[model samples]
Target: MKTTNLLMSMVIATTLFFVGCKPKDAAIQAAVQAKEATGITVAVTKGDVTLTGEVADEAAKAKAEEVAKAEKGVKTVINSLTVKPAPLPVVISEDPTLSKNVIDAVKDFPMVKATVKDGVVTLTGEIKKPALITLMQHLNALKPKKIENKLTVK
Candidate 1:
């Protein structure tokens, strides 16, 4: 009877060990699968997996989460993935490199202030002259998205 008790205890201990080990093993495996499934880089530390990288958009971020969750042993997924913003269309209007024509074009317009950032140009201020209509026509020819004309003829 003592031998049987010893055997049963050994069996129980072994089973507990296996059960404990299984989750850790599964966590590791899940991490691997998640890394493979999503091209995003994954770091697993202390049962928490952090995903990092740029994804196409919000939908892609959600898809990445789904992949991580479907894995067998992931306890928690802390997604650090960022959705890349859509690239703004390049403005050919005031490109310094494109043509000197756009440069010389704005030279005479004292009222129009042009500010360019990230390939976007913002035109602000005022203009007044019958000849200024010609100047504005030339400015519009430069191809900014839209001219914000705050000009009042004085």
Candidate 2:
């Protein structure tokens, strides 16, 4: 019984010693992912973390910093993130048929307005949140140079 107790104490002490040691990179990455900071990269060197990536928006960029800093063993957080929205496609061709087809495609959506600029299809107006995916399908079938989704969900 005495030997068993000694072994238990040793095991506990060893665990306590290493318990404070954490993988900084993995900790920061897990924290960022929990906050839905996709596309973010984390590099950790001796508890200093550097975050780099293009987030969806300014809010996402800020959240990334907050999460990285909150991670265990992170002494400092360096944020080198850029906020870049989706690129707008340049006008390739202007076709009346394209507009007509796009409009008909998303006609089920309410107050949906479609315009063709160059070869890109621009959709404006409001749609139900669920319908956005279906609308994309209909629009993609036409194969426009680019799609500008200006539609808002009601």
lDDT (Cα) of model 2? 0.79
Extract clashing residue pairs from model 1.
none
* Regions of model 2 farther than 4 Å from truth: 1-36, 89-154
Clashing residue pairs in all predictions, respectively, total: 0, 3
Number of the top lDDT candidate: 2
Roughly what TM-score does model 2 have, to 2 decimal places?
A: 0.41
Q: 1-154 in candidate 2: lDDT tens per residue?
A: 9999999999999998897565656766566556645588787777787888898888888888888787767789888999997899754434777877877887787578888877788888888877889889888878788999988888
State in Å the error of residue 37, model 1. 5.4
Model 1 local distance difference test score: 0.68
How do the residues 66-110 of candidate 1 rate in per-residue lDDT, one tens digit apiece? 777666667788888998889998656545642355457667877
TM-score of model number 1: 0.49
TM-score on alpha carbons, each prediction: 0.49, 0.41
